[model samples]
Target: MKATTLITVLLGTGSLLGLAGCADPVPEEPVPAPIPSVTPAPMPPKTPLQASHALFDETNLRTSNTVPTGGAAFLAGLEAAGFAADTLETTTDLTSVGLKAPSIQFAALVDSTCLIGQYGPGDTGYRSVIVAPLVTGGCLVGESHR
Candidate 1:
């Protein structure tokens, strides 16, 4: 063919070979190490009186069914939670004039301390507290059921 065409073909072939030899080699990626799993420790057991707080919440949540309403339900919850009837006390369901009492106060005497709780209607809600025994050596005074 022509001289210029032959020279162009030779130059193009030489450039391709030169570029191939000048390229750098690719590097390989390193493998990662494995991770270890960790476990948590267990907690110690609680006393019967200390467990009463949790039982009270459980009883309060399921009111009006499974157990009778008002003070008896709370007493049942306390009894089921390891309290004996002799150790329990509560306010009367009715006032001396025969009107319904607004709320009921109950207590479980553990040694000198009283684990006291007051349960009422939806508007009044419920509360539990740790209180000292009264002067007469009991929790409730005035009119009470036991």
Candidate 2:
């Protein structure tokens, strides 16, 4: 009876160990899909002043009557158009260029590029918008009346 009891206990223990081995492996925690990296959209390219220059080059520069009137207005327009306000320079005295009207000359340095604009009493709108290399200060693209 003792021998039979011992054999039964051993068989039971062996069966439990074998069952444990056969149990399904803890399903490997489903590897979470690698979170994709998010990248920001690139900014749109800056438009060159080609259109403004073309308008300036036209025979009748005053095609538009909606130009800013005074030096202050012109400077404000430049600031609104993404120009650096600190780099802006404006002067009413056109004596150096012999412009008779109470003209306003404005220049702004943007991205190491110089943009010059001229507006005055007689002109319908901005008379010129010139884009030039930084070397040429400002107002070099349009007629200076000199």
Candidate maximizing lDDT:
1
Candidate 1: regions farther than 4 A off: 1-49, 60-68
RMSD of each: 7.2, 15.8
Residue 96 local lDDT, model 1: 74
Q: In candidate 2, which residue pairs get closer than 3 Å at backbone N, Cα or C atoms, i.e. clash? A: none
User: Which residue pairs collide, candidate 1?
Assistant: none
Candidate 1 structure quality by residue, lDDT tens digits, 22-78: 988676787677766667666667776567656655665565344346677777767
Q: 8-102 in candidate 2: lDDT tens per residue?
A: 99999999999999999888768789989989899775466554334323422332244445566556655665566777776754455676456
Report lDDT (CA) for all predictions: 0.74, 0.58
How many clashing residue pairs are found in candidate 1?
0
Model 1 lDDT at residue 35: 62
